[model samples]
Target: MDAIKCHNLSFQQGEKCLLSRVNASFIAGKVNLILGQNGAGKSTLLKLLAKSQQPSSGVIDWREQDLQTLPLPELALQRAVVEQQQTMQFDFSVRQLVSLGLEIQLGSELVKAYQHVADFDVVLNRILQICDLGDLAERSVLNLSGGEFKRAHLARALAQIWPLQQTAQEQPDFSGKWLLLDEWNAALDMRHQQCFASLLKTWCAQGLGVIMVVHDLPLAQQLADRVLLLKDGQVFAEGDSQTVLQKTTLENGLQMQLQIVEQSDGKTMLLPKF
Candidate 1:
């Protein structure tokens, strides 16, 4: 069974259709990558799948039930979203901020204690390590680098999933959670990108589904199982990364001349030859 199934799902803002009759299924233990240029409604599609806004038509089914019918709390427990923009208005510490991710699944005590513990800090500590934010844990949010803050947000979402993972096993037949990361790659440098890609693949291996809206096509090619290419508010192509993101198709749909190239180190790369 598909983890997420969308049938004829469309959305609109009054007269303008942001998406049109989109049908696709997200499989378990895979990263479904959605790609498009700006204003191509990439974020809009993510919102529809996340059930943040009701679709204008069609249906979104998650784990056999209509997604709209699932209460917000149930949805929260089933999925976590990290949006493209994460400008926190609060002055919370980095550790305090990352701990916010576990608030939904975990209780109040350790979640709060996540902020100050220099020893045996549990989930917060674990995610700090996972997200590569260990050194920035004690820093004030207002003083962090942009990339650092994004990593903290990512850590929060990771903490949300990993710690609660044990409980899901106890509750067996658990409809595993899906991580929806929108433009999550924006701030990462080369090193972090590789790290994040590795982490995502590992998460999927452990039974979580990852659906990401990524503008970076090469990364998507390397990491995605399914690539959905959106253009002018419609699905231009949807299939394996190798098939849908081919040279001719990408060039016309994405309005850029893209060439698949091999690097000096012999690793493959997708760069615009234009």
Candidate 2:
């Protein structure tokens, strides 16, 4: 029951229906990838999950609790979201920006109280290292390259839900924590992509639940435990990765011929057949 479940979910803008009756469940402690062409309501569904936007109809439940009824302050401690486009108007340093995520979870007052604590520094430093932002920690957010900026925002989100009270020797329990990402790999190069992919797997192994919207079919095949394919704002296919990411299912849902190559390691690879 520790999952994100949507029942008959729908979203509308004027007369346009962005999503229609999308009933889906994404389990905890695994990577859930949402795939679709543009306008397939992928971003809409992610926003709804993040509670950044309200659905016109239906219910979204987190661990069998109605998401809308949860207090925002309480929810901030349980989940974090990273969106595709991030714009910063201020000249805060990378460290400052990442610390703001902790502030959101702990509130301004608690942040001021804990800013100098060893635990706070430990959590912040670990996130910066994991996100590859340790070197850029003191640099102004305005000066970062696209990839670095993306990593900074990701570090911030991680800091939001990071377990702050755990001892250094204790394994951090990420159960009930969720990370919602939209196009998380967009600005990263191949090296960073592989690096973050490994990091995601490690975190999920530690009980972090991830729901991501991505266009990378091969990456999804590599990481997804569950895959949801969308078409025309509806659930075209939803199941385990091996069941939902087949060549025929992808071709029909995406309207293109794609090649699926089975590697010697038993993993699959996808390629566009253009």
Candidate 3:
């Protein structure tokens, strides 16, 4: 199965447990949203799935293969992650930073050797356009506004797992590739957020798998195919969005009084009562 599975997953720092016995399966080619209040271990679980932090106990499997056994380079090709915070020490241009993702896909040495190849330029240009960073390609990363910087990083991550070898006639296949995002909408404005939602819809339909940790319930309600609710480092509930995001389940899990309103357009809206 092309899926990410966690079994008895737990994480701790010293004596403080951040996650406890988390077991879940996220299918490929779908949007999976993790929702919770602050300090609910949402980011912790995302880190574990990205393999950036090892679980103190239990295992994570990618396509039925043990995550720990995969080589770092191979894993890099199969997955890309965008964290809540981004920091850069060097003064690299947005184009340069984004190119690093391509370097990971095709070795740095090869990129340095053939930096001006036609195919490389094609892929990079497409990614820049998809991420809406074409105009900022040459801008210094340090000079970008918060929203611009976030989009730049998103473009880079997308470049990391882009199907570079596929010919123009071949359909893009992202069956084994995964994108893990943590608070990706933090700096993005409403317009950009909508653009991102549309992009995810298109990519997921083309076999891209996405797992994101977000606090935006309304956006999650619109984008998620599967929803996982975490509370106090545990899975309070999880299932298809329609099944898990009911009024009572969300209220109990998030400790908030929420109203689910049905619009004339036949869309559901989640509103929190103050």
Candidate 4:
């Protein structure tokens, strides 16, 4: 019943139409992957859904509540966004940066009474461990390597909605909680990428809705419960992983011939057919 519903979603800048009349719904307890070739509006859609950009002509409703009507604090509790760009002008340690996720308007008395402080630490610590930032918790985020910086932000976004059930109860008006990411794993190494995938799987299992823009087709297939393939600023194909990931759709969406190979281990690999 709780879901993000979009209607006639369109965004424009000057004369360019980034997105046009898009309609879809992203439900909880699932990993929704958005895939498209460069400039196909995948990142733009994520921004609109994250409320970082206003849709030119559309409505985004989170569990029947219009997204634009919600307050900033309420929206922050309902959704956390991780963008592709990472930057911090000021010096701040990883732990301090991650702790900013707890800046919501919860009463101190209620927080203490509900045992939120302890639960918050549990969520924060787990995110740090998952992102492999326990060693760098004290390290300045600005000085960390690119991969480390990316992981720190990932941890922060997850921390924003960590112990999601409690946060939902604390902010009942924001029931359709979501984690929105734009190419979040683009900077990670192979091992870290796999680790990140595992971490997201664990969160989705706990009823957290995840919508991410990704370029890795194999990774998308492996993790996505649903896939939305965009082309020319519109929905080219959308459905379960198996339905939207066909070779034809991949070729059409990407504008290149691709060879899909299946391994003995039941994994699908995408190869450019030269």
Give lDDT tens digits, candidate 1, residues 1-274: 6579889988889899888888877877889988888888889989988888899999999889999889887777778888898777778988888777766565446556455534326656767877888888888888988788788888877666654434322421223878889989899878998999998887787677888998787787789898888888888888887788788888877899777788888977778775
- Candidate 4: worst 10 consecutive residues by lDDT? 167-176
Q: What are the per-model numbers of colliding residue pairs?
A: 0, 0, 0, 0
User: What is the lDDT, from 0 to 100, of the residue 144 in candidate 2?
Assistant: 94
Instruction: Give the Cα error of residue 87 in candidate 1, in Å.
Output: 1.8
- Candidate 4 per-residue lDDT, tens place, 1-274, comes to 8788889899999999999988888888789999999999999999989888999999998778898998777788778999999789889999878877754534336454455455666566666876799999999987999989998988888777765355523422223568999998899999999998987787677677899999887788789999888887898988898888888889988899888788899877777788
Model 2 reaches what TM-score against the true structure?
Answer: 0.95
lDDT (tens digit, per residue) of candidate 3 on 50-159: 88899999999888899999888889998999989989878999998898887787665754666666788788887898789999999999999999999999989988
Off by over 4 Å in 1: 107-120, 165-175, 263-268
Per residue, candidate 2 scores C-alpha lDDT tens digits across 1-274 of 6899999999999999999999999999999999999999999999999898999999999888999998878888889999999898899999999998977765657446555655677788878988888899999999999999999998999889887778766777888899999999999988999999998898898899999999987798889999999999999999999899888999999888898777999866888887
Q: Where is model 2 more than 4 Å wrong at Cα?
A: 108-115
Per-model CA lDDT versus the true structure: 0.80, 0.90, 0.90, 0.82
TM-score to native of every candidate shown: 0.88, 0.95, 0.95, 0.89
- What range of 10 consecutive residues in model 3 has the weakest lDDT sum? 108-117
Model 2 residue 58 lDDT?
Answer: 97
